[model samples]
Target: MKKQTHTVLKNVFGYENFRPLQEEIINRTIDGKDSFVLMPTGGGKSICFQIPALVFDGITIVVSPLISLMKDQVQALKSNGIKADFFNSSISPQEENEVINRAIKGDLQLLYLSPEKLISVRNTWLKQLNIKLVAIDEAHCVSMWGHDFRPEYTQLKVFRNSLPQVPFMALTATADKSARKDIEEQLGLTNSKLFISSFDRKNLSIEVRGQVQKKKKLQEIVNFIERRKNESGIIYCLSRKNTEEVTSYLKAEGHSVAFYHAGMNHEEREKTQTDFINDDTKIIVATIAFGMGIDKSNVRFVIHYNLPKNLEGYYQEIGRAGRDGLPSETLLYYNMRDFVLYSQFADGGANSVMQKEKLNRMLQFAEAKSCRRKILLSYFGEHLTDNCGNCDVCENPPKDFEGTILTQKALSGIARMGQTDGITMLINVLRGSNNADIHTKQYFNLKTYGIGKDVSFFDWRDYVIQMANQGLIEIMYAESSALKITPIGWEVLKGDKTIRLTVPTSPSDKKKQQKVAKITTGNDTNKDLFTELKKIRYAISKEEKVPAYIIFNDKSLKLMASQLPVTENEFLAISGVGMNKMEKYGEEFMQVIRKFKSVSKPRKTPTTDKTFILYKEGLSATEIAEKRSLSITTIFSHLSQLYSEGKEVELEKYVTKEIVDKVRIAFNKLDRKVELKPIYEKLNEEVSYGEIRLSVTLILKNE
Candidate 1:
């Protein structure tokens, strides 16, 4: 059975191997048992049941909530030579009957229907078919604890009783533990095995920016979009009006963007979605109503223009990007105003308490000082022990410095001034201001006067706030908003305790923080080849009337460009290339690859070679990173790649022997060809990613 599943996986799905837990779930379901899958979006949840459907003799019934989702999956499945179709309102009655007829004749392997449609057809239409497996996509909708609760999904339990012999599999991308339990109970999967894959989408870099003025936020968005021109992205807004406003702003800035919202008519919404899927539209500024059913895998970025109401919704929304397993970016702009508005929106509902609680967690994530990915994964009950270096916090941590002297000066000024003034008055006293209030109070008589005279007034305010936050002082709001010293504050003043304060980010620092590392090909030739392949994919998509990704995702095209596959045999070896696709679109793509490879010359001085030269000059990785303005992780990754190419790199100097042994043990236990993340986790995350890379390179070098 496992071999059959693997065969089907390779021949039908074009995947060389199963993702973690996918094979186990598929085998359990094939053995006529129930399984509940809690995998992240783009984590191969479809293949769990789709492969079993092909392996089973009878057809599989997949209950999906959105027509767009059903259509997307069915289109991709049919393109792979699998007989699949969807039954929804989007299809005519004749087409629905035709699908039913095909299913009855055993000509179709998978049939998709929405929850409402399935319930409606349960008595009249479902009894006529031989259903082998029942798979529910977006199974979270069945649970009230889920972010997207649909009452119709509650009626889907009827399938368990009606098709008692058929195995059931429920899947969702963003369900917390509560939602997971509720889904099982609601779906009557009492004896089902639950599988939760890692929620970390390593390809998506998470970031959050807050406290910017409205104009500046818009300008930042414009700047972000400008850098990734022609790449697809989405900007989620809090309201329909905000969506239209952002869309207009982007358009005025000369972008191929559009707005999508519930308020837009169906035709308008479909056209916008179609344009986006076809790559004719580069950006979609929309409210939360836009991305649930979208299966477009090439979304390069996702921007939350306003704060999301809850972490579940936010996670699923950001999951829309990098679905093709390539690097993507997710930026969230939030403020207190968005929190207040969402709080009000969550009020008076039955789940109001839960909603507000989730919103609070979301806000905490936006305001978090730790790794943003850790906070997000922990919210979904996936604890990441190591800080993912891909997030904004890990990349650009706070500049902490020993601020004992700074705190002592402010505390001494506050005590000498009788501890009776507000923050502004304290600042004035410390900076030796000659203001009327300070002079009238004769605060200049304080011995600590002019102690902080060299410090700027703005810097003093920041220091005072930090002191209050650190419990070194208190802001007595009830006592006429006076600044009072706490016991901890006295200890600092008396030199008993030391404290560290982070340097506040200035406007220029904020601009520097907005820069993201671009995902690039190895050289100019690979990039040109990739561009040509995308054109071919888009042309085929136009001719076939499907999303370009349904033909071949950007990941596949990238691999084609990098490997320069110009023959059918070589093209078939590419990922996402089944024999069906190889037979259909292979020649055209091969033609492009052949022409590009024929004309392209060998490159000189690749990016990694530059790093090698710098390494040879005796500069440390940190020093090189500082000089190049690149992250230290990137520098290490470059060196690791150079080592992989058999270059003379002393990669051992970057990692300790203890780390090398741990990584070696982890790699030997797991699939060695897998990415670095699984190995990082297998080592219990005690090793940093850079350390893991260096250790793995050393292990392979020794082997």
Candidate 2:
């Protein structure tokens, strides 16, 4: 099974080997066992079921959540020479019938469906077919505890019960402990084997910025995007108005941009999505309604104009970048106002308490003083022993100083003020303000009242927020927006514990602190060659009516430029090349490489002598020399000069074929593109430098 899987990996999918747990999951499913897989997006979850579908004797039914996802997956599978199709609302009646008939006849190896369609058709064509395995994608949606819950998914249990003998596999990218348990219970998975891959995308560099003024923030975003010109990206805003404004601003700046929201008509939204997927638009300023199941693999960045509502949503949004295993980036801009806005929205929901808790956790992540990756992974129930150096915090770490005195002052103020006020009031009390509330409460008479008066209001506020994020103080949202001191704060006040807080640096200062390393490639790499190769790829993609990455991703093109493969075997050795791709497009690409190699060879200028001109006119060199009143030896020199210049010369008239063959052998024995001295020495200096040069030039020209 392992050997067969490897064969399928190379020959069909063009991959070299299985990702971490793909083989184990495939083996379990082939043995007819229930499996629950929780791997991140772009983590090769499709291969787990696709491999077993090819290995099993019957067809596999994959339940997808979105029509677009189904279409993309089916197209990708067909491109890899797999027998796959999808049955969804987007397809015509005749098309659906053809797919159903194919499935009934066992002509298709894999079939895709939505939960609503699958459950509704349980007793219809689905029950009659020989179903081998049932694979549920986006399985977290079945759990009400999941972030993106769909009520129709709850009916899948009934559909699962009807096919009790077949193995069931549920897969998702993001799921917490509670959601995982709910998924298992809701899906009715009995004795299922669980496979949880790490949720770390090492290629994505995560960065968060506290919101500045609107103009400054917009300029910052523009600068970020300018660095990644002509690349596809997604900019997520919190509202339709923001999306429109951002899209307009970027468009005014000459960027290819579009906006998407629920307020638009169906046709408008479809057009926007289609344009983005086809790379006609470089950026999409969209709300949360967009990008649930988007399958575009070359997105280079994902920027949040505002903070997301939860860790799950943020993680899933950032997962859209770098899907092609290339370097990508994610930027999140957040502030206290966004948190307040989210809190207000949560207050009106049914699960207000849970929503607020989730929002608070997200806030803590944004204000974290340590590695952002650590905080993000820990939220998904994975612990990291070391800091991931890819994120902003790890790259430009905040300055740490002894903040015990500051922490004690803030804690004493909160404690002495009766813990019945929010951050503003607490900061006011610390600064000894003369406001009406302070006078009414007589809060200025406390021992800790004016202790922090030397610090400005904004500075005190930032320090207090930092303390809250570090768990020295807790924000009691349900208790009239009061602040409560924790045990750690008490310890700090009593001088029993020391506290260290990170000083907030300005954005410009932080930017100056970052030092990027340079990347070097092989000597064969040429920028002009890479551009020419890209032109070929773009032409092929246009002809096929597919995105450029579908033919060959940017990483594959870079490898092609660096290695410069010129033969079938060498082209196949490139990373993304498989048997199918090599057979389909190998010869065309190799032709380009061969032509480039021939044109790039160093050549001397053509000779300009009248003797050479006469020789080229079909006159003998001796005759030309005699006609021109010059010596025969001089004409021979002129002939050697013409041959060395890579021009056509009658080499047989001067040197015999045997001598030319010996010189060619000597040149071949030495390294390619070497000077003539090495070949002369290797030939024992029997041939003169001029004759040797002429013979080498003729041999190279023939090659």
**TM-score of every candidate relative to the true structure:** 0.75, 0.77
Error of 2 at 228 (Å): 1.2
Name the candidate that leads on TM-score: 2
C-alpha-based local distance difference test score of model 1? 0.84
Model 2 Cα displacement at 446 (Å)?
12
lDDT of 2 at 482: 83
lDDT tens string, model 2, 1-703? Answer: 7766765665566666688999999988988899999999888898999988977878999998888788778877766557899998888999989999999999999999988889878888887899999999999999878888999999999888888889999999988898999998899997998899989998888888874557888888888777667889999999999999999999888899999999999789878887787778989999989887688888989999999999999999999998888778888988777888888888898678888889989988988878999999988889999999878788778898999998898888888888888888888888888899989999989888878889887677778888887778887765765899888888888999999877774554234223221222234436567777878877886777666666666677777776677754456556666655665677777788777777776224322356667876889766886797643433565676566666677676676778789888877777554354456557864665446655765676666
Per-residue alpha-carbon lDDT of model 1 for 1-703, expressed as tens digits?
Answer: 7866865665556677799999999889988999999999899999999999988888999999988888889999999888899998888988888988897888888999998889888898678888999999999999989888999999988777777778999999988888888999899885899898999999888878766668989998998888888999999999999999989999999999999999989999989998998899999999999989899999999999999988888999999999999888898888656766666677767788888888867866876667888888887777988999888788777788999998998998888878888787888888888889978888888887778899887577667767876788876544655789999889889999999987764433243334444355467768888998999899999999999999999999999989776644357557898756876888899988878866886445556778888999999999987887654655777888888888888887888888788888898888685355567557754576568768877888787
TM-score of decoy 1:
0.75
Q: For each candidate in the order shown, give its overall lDDT on alpha carbons.
A: 0.84, 0.80
- What are the runs in model 1 whose C-alpha is more than 4 Å off? 401-500, 506-519, 601-703
| RMSD of each candidate relative to the true structure | 15.2, 14.4
Clashes of each: 0, 0
